[model samples]
Target: LSFSLPKCDTMERFAGRVTVYSVVGCPHCNSAKAFLKGLGLPYCEVDVEKDSTVRQKVKELTGRSTVPQIFFNKTHIGGNDDLQNLVSNNGFFSPQIKKKKKNKPSDLMIPSIPCFTDVKGERDNFAELILEFKSSGIIKSHGSFLKVHKLTFSGSELIEWLVDKKGFEKDQALNTGKELMQKKFFSDVSGKGDFQDGHTLYRLIEHDCLTALNSGKTAECSPVLAAELSEALRRLILKLYGEHLSPDGKTVDYKAMENSQTFQEYCELATQLQRLELKSMTREEKLAFFINVYNALVIHGHIKMGPPKNLWQRYKFFNGVSYLIGGEVFTLQDIENGVLRGNRKGVGQLTKPFSQGDQRLQVALPEAEPLIHFALNCGAKGCPAIRSYSAKTVDAQLKTAGEAFLEGDDGCHVNSCKNEIRLSQIFKWYKVDFGDTNEKLLQWVAEHMADSPKKKELKELLGKGNHKVVFLPYDWSSNSKD
Candidate 1:
């Protein structure tokens, strides 16, 4: 099919036979096709894997074995990157179109196309936007489609909300909704159509619902008895750790967890959290429950929105993504700094997580537990290992966790020659919980460490005064299984 270029000074009319060489399961190939479709251009796609001869021809012509070698009227255009660069530079329409010498493409600016990169940040941002829609009463389950009840909203309503609430132009909002649909964020209720600006009912996927609870939805059945719910959460986390997490908890198979039946069950079970009575739980029970929930929630967040890539993304991830429990929403930041840390302000925060009037404050511990630094895993390479905690054995479990983390190079290191000790950044961030001073911090570390040569050295160093404390840089790389 012929395609026309937007109005340009030099090129009045343009049409070309666009073709794309592709293969199954190639992400870049799919992106190239989406880019073309977004531009309203129709192209012929050839699967090179089906025939050796065509594959050889492609390699010979492009001098590359990549599947997505695009062409315009048989003129080679390299791969996905080349197509984007050509378009962004306004050099795709004609040879006679002069490139402006003064307006060279900026090295810092990368051309972006809709659905080009599966950026976890954008997915997360979109998910939060959808949650906002739900909270604003824009999305509801009150409508019936084909005599069957479904949690859904109309496409026009979504587009309107995006435009009015998010400040997106009508066209931009439509494209944004389409991108969300392609990413499986939501789908037409009948499972047969793309997102459109019309009265078509669409439902958010099951996994997306984990991030936010229904605005006023409560359990129809008697709350799964607290005992049963607690036990189920414990068992589910244990199963998840056994099947998808490494023995040391440094690596996680999030991809496998995403597809497992256990995870799906966990998602279904999370809804029951709304009915839980947190005030009745003992401190030990709260410790175990919050720790398990925190670790599992990190994995759940990763599966729903990809792992955070930078400090800002991490900030959004820890503060934005959450689960609705006991009719309250608890973000990763809330559970850690609010409940587990006794409602103290977390690192880089200006105020406490829970206010005096907030209901969540009732669940906060009287004081921060120091050992929790070792039990809480933030899905980062430098974070402590993950393990299932049981209320009956939580104290012992946390002690073990603290000991295990201290033994690792990432946790503590002593350089006697320099009269200094290097410790995990966790100590620096929550030094108040540890002791609030270098001497006290060292003493606490020395006392809690397991009996080992390093522990002995740390103790000796602590006894001797004038030792400098250095906190190692925390690694924020994803602890994902390759």
Candidate 2:
């Protein structure tokens, strides 16, 4: 049988209620249960000895054979010492839960272009255009014009767009368009010609263009834009002092990151990115850009200030340095919440899309990719390993990273013998991003681990979704070089 916490809407639901597992004649268990009664709190007492199943389950769930184990809304608040500490910290009052507000129509009304309907050929053509853009990393010429969100390319540009953006290594990109033209997606001068001259241009049928763009799910910003930034940072890290993932996959070499030349070069890149026309970037580019920027700035912060000695100091690290981007100064939190996480209302983050038309927002990505949690590194031992992200392969790369991280002890621990699964606190904090519930999360884990050794075990646990998912306590120690 499986057991998990019931979903509660308010802190009031658990305010006066508690649970304790104990033995029939233990003084400590009696005192703990009595303490709850003294506070006028309602509680259920389970005699572990009476039910061997509960006894074994409790042992596996708490990693302890002793009782009285206590709980509030399924949150394991720990034993006697932990109980007293909780009371001392907040006078025995449970923390407040902020209610999520209802969303309105106005909030949901995002700007969108029209979608193609009743025209399979047009849809196919548009799909090809998006695929072409994906393979080619070159920016559409005519300066600042591509930023306007229209596809207007010269004949010559189409060849490179196909070869570069679409990864056309085997097929002839030039002839592919000719084959597509028979499908009626493209048009030449007066609707007929052998493609030639500066005047010859390929354009998408302009009907609800944004809708068409949205349907493709292709990133608007050139892959080159994201690739350039990744390469730049990669070069700096490699040239100054090489960086490597630790054996535990949790630490980085701090001394290597603090190279003066590397720090200086990063500062320039940071400033340069800020000054660029970032507002016009596509959703994929924005995601790639900010991920790189956040990771880079984090490394820069460490190098400049040395490693933060404590959790308080690490948080303050973001507060200490303010980098200028897009004519505005941003702290590390701003990029994290404002840009990548989309700062949705009722989430306790500042309410505002970091930039207008940013595709990273929840409205755009809908369910944000949870794998991103494993892709971004916050310079903490518990954080995911740092990696270069590009628009071209960000999605696939994140999946790979997520799998690698889970394979490590720092990210996941499964004890089939004990019937327990321990995961990083990231799963706890961003539960919604992963599937909004533990059951769904387990399904996701099972699906992603199809090729992993744990596949069979996870599959066996499928409908039984009752397994406990305990988030291991986060370690805030510096993950830098010794």
The best candidate by TM-score is 1
Where does candidate 2 clash, by residue pair? 113-211, 114-208, 135-164, 135-165, 135-166, 136-164, 136-165, 136-166, 254-481
TM-score of each: 0.55, 0.48
Cα-based lDDT for every prediction:
0.70, 0.54
lDDT of 1 at 249: 38
Candidate 2 per-residue C-alpha lDDT over 255-370 given as tens digits, one digit per residue, 9 for 90 to 100: 65554665555444443332233556666776676677777767677766776787578667765544544323456666665566655321333455355644223223333556
Model 1: colliding residue pairs: none
For residues 1-482, write the lDDT of model 1, one tens digit per residue: 12211122221133444568775423456667777766655666765544445655676676554457886654677787677666645424333212221222221211221221111111234546656766777666645465853567888989998999889999999999998776445667765668899988886654334446322332323344344465566456546655776433346677888899988777666655654568888899889888878876777788778899988999999998787766467899999999999999999899999987787888889999999999888878788755546677778668867876887778999999998899999999999999978888889999998777888888787778868999999999986777
Could you tell me how far off, in angstroms, the CA of residue 83 lies in candidate 1 after the best superposition? 50
TM-score of 1: 0.55
Error of 1 at 179 (Å): 42
Kindly report the root-mean-square deviation of model 1 from the true structure over all alpha carbons: 22.5
Q: Model 1, which residues run further than 4 Å from truth?
A: 1-221, 224-231, 241-253
**lDDT of candidate model 2 versus the reference:** 0.54
